[model samples]
Structure formats: C-alpha cells, structure tokens
Target: MVENRRRSEEPLHCLVTGASGYIGGRLVPELLAAGHRVRCMARSPGKLRDHPWAGDVDTVRGDVQDAESVAAALRGIDVAYYLVHSGSGAGFEAADRRAAEIFAAQADACGVQRIVYLGGLTPRGIPESSISPHLRSRAEVGHVFLDGPVPATVLRAAVVIGSGSASFEMLRYLTERLPVMVTPSWVHTRTQPIGVRDVLRYLVGSATMTDEVDRAFDIGGPEVLTYREMMCRYAAVAGLPRRLIVPVPVLTPRLSSHWVGLVTPVPAALARPLTESLRYEVVCSEHDIATYVPDLPGRPLPFDEALSLALRRVREAQVATRWSSASAPGAPSDPLPTDPDWAGGSLYQDERLSPVDASGEALWRVVEGIGGENGWYSFPLAWAVRGWLDRFVGGVGLRRGRRDTERLRVGDSLDFWRVEEIEPGRLLRLRAEMRLPGLAWLEMWVETDPQGGTRYRQRALFHPRGLLGHVYWWLVLPFHALVFGGMTRNITLAAVKGAPARVNEARAVRIRGDRRTRRTSQR
Candidate 1:
C-alpha cells in the first residue's frame, strides 16, 4: 500500500520556453522549489548549463518557431510557459505573432493541459490603435494562447524591478548618474510596477490553479506611481540625494531613446520600445489574480521595498540571471577562439611581462583567483567605472565575478569574461563578454625562467570590426595603461607575497610593472 501511494504522488511536469531569458532563468529555480519537475528549452542548451539549478531540471534544445522542437518540449508537460518575445529588431511584431501561432499549435497538438504566458500590461484610457507596438505584440501573443484549445492563463505585468532586469537598470542608471535632468512629459505618466520576486510567485502559483482560470489577469505591486516618483523612491531607498526634475515635452520618445541608449546599458532597439510604452499609464485593471492565486504569506512589496531587494542582490553579487544572458541573434555559440591566429582579422595587442621570484604554482594561484572578492589586481576604481559603463549599455559588467575563487574550469564566468582555456598551472584565457565593438581577449600564463625564476606574461588582444573598434581601443588606451600595467605588477607582487612562509626566497623578492619593457605578443 505504501508503494502504491508513492507511485500515485508524482509531481507535475512543466516545460519552460525562453529558458535563456531573464524571467525564464529565474522561473526554473522557483518551479523546482515548488516541487514541480521542469524542462527548460533553449536555442543553445549550453547557455543554461552554468546556472545553479542546471542539474535540477532537464533541458531540451529547441526553438519555439520550430514545430518539431516545440512538440518535443511539450511532450508530457502539464503546463507550458510561453515567455519569449521578439520585440527588438525590424518586423518583430510579425515575428512574435508567427512564433505564438506555432507555439500554441504545438502545445495543442501535444495535448498540454494548460498554457501560462507572461505579457505586458495594456495601457488604460487609450485606444487600441494608439497602443505601443511592444504592449500590443505582448497582448496579441497572450490572445493566441487564450484562443488555443488548451486552457490558459495570461499574467500581464508592468515594469519588473529586479537586479539585471533591463527596465530596472534604466531607472537605476538614470537616477544614479543625473542628479538633475530634463525629462519628457511621460515621466509623470502613472503606472504600476511589480517586483520580480512577486511576479515569479504569481507565475509559479498560477500553475496550480484549475482550468476555471482561462482569461487574462493583471498583476502589479501595491503602489501606483509615476516613473518620476519611482525613480525618487528608488533614490530614497538607495540613500541617494534628492534629484531635480524639469519636465519638457520637446524630447520625444525617439530622442529619449537615444539619450537612454547612451546613458543606460539598454540599446536603442530596446530603449525605443520601453520609451514608447511609457507614454501611457499601465496599472492593474482587474484584481482577478488576487482572488484566483491570492498573495503568498504577506502583503506584496511596495516600490521601495522591491527596489531595496534588487539593490541587495547587486551588493551581494548573487544575481541568478541577467537580461543579457540570451545569446546575441547571430553570435557564435561555440567557445571563443583560443588559438592566437584562429581567425583572420586585424589584431592589436598590449602585452606586459613581470619577472617573479616564485614557483609557477604560486603564481597560478594568484591568477586563478584574480576576480570576485579578491578584486582585480589593478586600478579597481577604473575597473568599476568600466563595469558601470558596460552595465549602462546592456553588458554583463563586473558583478558576475568568478564562480570559484581557488579554481577555474573552461566555460566558467569571470566577471564580464568567459574562461576559454585553463592549462592547469601554465595558462588561462578569457574571452570578453562585455559589450564591445570587436572581439577581445585577455590571456595570462606563467613559465619557468632559465634563471630559476618565474616569468608571467599578460596580453590584451583585440580584432577590430571597423573604424569604431579601432577608435574604441585607442580611446581607452590610456586607461588600459593604468589598469593593465598596475594589474601585471600587482599580480606578480601578490604571487611573491602569497608564497608559503617556508619559501623564504619568494617572500624576500619584489616586483614592479615597467611599461618600457612592453612588447606585442603573437596574434
């Protein structure tokens, strides 16, 4: 009888599309915590392999636009999550509609019981014809799922505030960078914003609701505030000083997008959609979700509380997912080039060498533990500025750090870089993941000198795309001097000082960076 009861207590199996996306990445862990089995579908399954919960669920390699892959993913899935959106490039609306049609058809064919989709909250008191393309596409996708044969629940939310979220980052940078600003009239447009944590809760909870929930439900945080008010509240929570605002209607969404593109990490494509949507107010029109799923144990977090949570995650360096995790549309998914001349392209390099009176193993320890809590072995302030700039333009930034301090494996993330090669005590290669105009890499290695000492080589290599890449490198060359030169000196010094107490030979010696000794490495 016990065996029979155990067999009857099987968990529900769910398939999550867009597993590489921001909310989808976080949603997998939440679903697992809720005792449901999850299957993540990604165009490149390798992208999900590094996630903390990677081992907890199954992954299927597929795209929603491909009917076969969709059917395969939907096989035996009780609930399917449609979290994908093509709101970036040209004709994204048509692309979104086609993807939704294919997904709904496949889910129905696979006999999935219910489909749960997350979309944007529609603007209130506005005609459908005048609705922003971003919101309109989202609503249409939700409609496709609801109209399918399977029962479906559509959860529409406003801006989601969380660490690494594109929407939240825009607000964060704008408020932090500018104490006084000329703003568009849309800054005063009232809208409801929701915490990512609360949104996740609603998403996970909706899976358990019965088929009686077949329509759309609007979800949001407890407060309905203007974008201006939200930014001010964020500043208050973050302990930032009061900001001055001047409203101006002359700055249209296009102009605002360009300005935001320059200031924030979000590019013009994403910024345009966001700015367009902000022209109208987006508040929860119905309380159906509250009645259907109910609040988790306490009142939902207000704007300030949510903003605090996001900041805490950033401070702790515990971000589970970033908005940039999704692979670029045509980027190569394979590991970055490790061979110096693997690709035929124009190359420029900066190389530095430091002689250390330590063993190769000793030097390797310092190199392996270069990032994370140890910090970069150079101009930390400059590194922080670059990281901030990267984050503003939708790059990974330096917040990711290293997965392991004492050790590294190929494919591990080191700050805004991905490890491409690790040769034990000999070498380490990192491919830049931060937004750049060209391909770049930082390589380091330790070798035994013929004179019974350790020699460390550090090189920064770039393959320019066009004039932009060349200008970018030259523009930052001076900063690189302070960063790279100091980095080489400090790394060798750390190796010498960090040598075991018994190694008196290493402990007695010192090293310093000499830019005059610099030479370009083979590329």
Candidate 2:
C-alpha cells in the first residue's frame, strides 16, 4: 500500500463523470477511501442514490451533452475523471467527439487543475486512419482533452479484464460455452490486456503525483499474449476443458460479431467494433507512467492471477459495476411509466394474483430472490431456452443476473431487466432491457388481504408499437400460459410453508383505474 502522508496542501476535490459506469463507479469509492472529496455526475441521479457509498460523496445530476450541466459539475473540482464512452458502434465516434470537446471546454473554463481520461490503446507505428473506429474515437477524445487549456493526463489501455466488463464477459462466454470454435485470424493478433485493479491504481496514483502530467501514458499487464492464447489461458485458469480454436482467414468482422452475438450476451452492435480492433496488436509501447507513479503496491499482476480474480467476482456475484450500466447512445429516454391510458399504445398484460397463508415478508422474500442462481422459481429449462434465444437474436439475455441474492433497490439489474422502482417488502418493478418489439415491465407486489394473510401479485405489461407488436404478443401468448403461469405457481409453493396457497385468478390488465377494465380467467 502507498504510504498515506499528511499533506500540507488542502484535500483535492474530484469530479467523476459517468460515475454510474463500470470504471467510474468503482473509482468513486477508491477516491473516497483515499480521503479525497468526490463529486459524482450522472444523468439519472436516482440511479446513484441507493449505491453503498451514495451518501459518502456529493452527486451532480447532469449529462456531458449539456454544456451548462458539465460546467456546473466541473465547478470547484480540482481533478476530473472523464470515464464516459459511446458503446454503440454506429456513428458513435461523432457523438464521442462532440461530448469530449464540450467536456474539455467546460473543464478548462472552470479552472480544473487536472483532467484524466481513460482511452483505448492503438499500437505505435500504425497510421491514425487504419485504427478501428472505437479506438480512433478514444484517441481523438484524448487529444481533445489534451489540447484544451487544462493540463490533461490521458491513460491508454487495452482490454480491461474484469467481471462485468464487456470484453471479459465476451471472452468468458466464448470460452465456457464453446468446446470447439472456428475463430477469426485476429485471434492470433497480440494484445496486452490489463486488470481493472491496476487500472484503478494508476488512476488513483495520478491524483497524488507532484509533477504536472500533460501527455498520454500506455499501461498494460506484464504479459503479452494473442487473443486465442488469452482465451485458452482463461479456460485453463477457470479449470475448463481445453478449447479447440480453428483459425480462419475469411471470417470478416461482421461475421465474427454475429458469431459472438449468438454465443455471448454481447450484442452485434457492441461486438463489431471490438472485433475490428482485435486485428492489430495492442501491447504497450512505452513505460512513461512508471516514472510518475513509481513502485505501485504491485506494479502488474500475472495474467493467471488477474483472470482468476475476475472469475471469483463473477462466481460470488460481487461485481461492482457493469459495462451496460450506462444507457446506450441514441437510446430513447425511458421516463417513469405513468397511467396505462396515458402511455399511448395498445397495451397488453399478463397478471396473476395468489393468496397465501404466509406473511408479506416471506412472500416478498421469494419474489426478491427470483432470478439468478435461484433458477427462476420454475421452468428453469424454459427460462434458459428463452435466454439463449434472446442472445441468439443479439439481445441482452439472462447473463446479467441479479447483483444481490436477497436485497434489491432501484437501478439494480435483475437478469435482462432494470429495477425501475422498489418499495421494500411491498413492490418491485423491473423495466425490460432485452430486445423486444415493445416496451415491457415485470412487477411484483405484496399486500395484506382482508383475512389477515398475504396476497402476492405479479404483472407483465407490454405496450406494443405497431402491427408487428400485436402479432408478437399473440405469438407468445400460448407460451406465457406455461412460463408465466408456472412461475406464479412455483413462487407460491416456495413462499407458503406448511400452509397451502390458492391461486386466485389470472387477469388481463391495462394501466389506469384498477377496477375499470379487467378480464379474469379462473384456473
């Protein structure tokens, strides 16, 4: 550990944009633990409210797209961490450029002493035009910050191997799911992957440097290996059987992306850029960062150790943040759902209410622990098939399981949905993020019945977009009877101990005055 010295200077005030994102979320607590005052900026501040360290720092509700908000967030900040990125592969470079320019200008105008940006690494000696769009955007953004008035330190890194990170997850799913693979030629291209711990250490160390930093530093793990080797090594470390990778020269990036999308939770849009970048070597070409932050607690961890640490987090469900935490670029804003009639669409729903002899607390406990390793209460094989289908079609799938087993709060990702709202022991509403023809929500509520027992209610709502939406609903209605019906029945069985619970009825619900329009079906 670095010695914590009593500094004569005042404690630095830091601002972290994308504080809800993977790296940013993890970095906030690190800065706080180091005794520096931190301000977290997020577009949706509600998402950050229930974080474990929420109350420990100040939060500014704002987006980098808005100049005024960026300016406000930058005010009174000594050091700023720009950790935001556009993961959408199409036309994201332009958006990233605009945001970076605005942030740089705001930081400069606000007199921020130092600005640090995390960017992707492009190998030395390659022309700028030859770089992948993703890496190109990152390099350009770094330049924007460096060219601005403030002294900027840009740290370029390759794939960060961490649990919940997109790259790590892609590697994980590919290795674990496929026994033999026809891989692309890029798999043999060398890359210097770094662990998240080292990346965070370098970031925190940057804050304490006495000398001014105005240039870019390339950072990576000590070992350099090809993508194919990394995958085999990962499988070896995880104790999986050896995976056979048959390399092919004809598979294009689009084809590789589709293959990856089908096998992994990653979408084709996000996977394409990453696939393209793998064609070139990404090993670090310089060691300038060591001069600034010398003798880091552990300069660099071994590849096996880094891979194991990430896997351990996955197995333990202790992932701090995910790459998908931030909203995608150009995605329409999802406002808090209001009344059903006001929603402006042909809305359809599947509702189930069951009366149990158990207390509200017991029923709520079962609902809260529905997804992940708990196995969806019932029809686990069906659930797994659905998740695989979603992944096949480039949807999020169920790979992003529950963050916690028993406790949940708003903004938590449960399987393929996000917790839109939660009331302890009373209600849980999850907004769907999976690929769908319409918007969807799964809500569970616990209430006390007049007879002094608990009533468990489950609702799945969908607001269709067009004719295809209606068709999709009808097509899946038959399966819902099996999947959703079994789900309600099983949840009741799990909740009610010793005392038998009775299924009340299934109803078709539309949001609005509850009693107005309801069609009940008795089992």
Using all chains and alpha carbons, the TM-scores for the candidates as numbered come to 0.68, 0.66
Off by over 4 Å in 2: 1-9, 314-523
Worst 10 residues of 2 by lDDT: 331-340
Q: What is the per-residue lDDT of model 1 for residues 314-428, given as tens digits with 9 covering 90 to 100?
A: 2332211221122211111111112112111235688998899777888888888778877888888988998999999999999898776467998999999888778899888
Winner by lDDT: 1
State the displacement of the C-alpha of residue 155, model 1, in Å, after optimal TM-score superposition. Answer: 0.2
Deviation (Å) of 52 in candidate 1: 1.4
lDDT of 2 at 247: 96
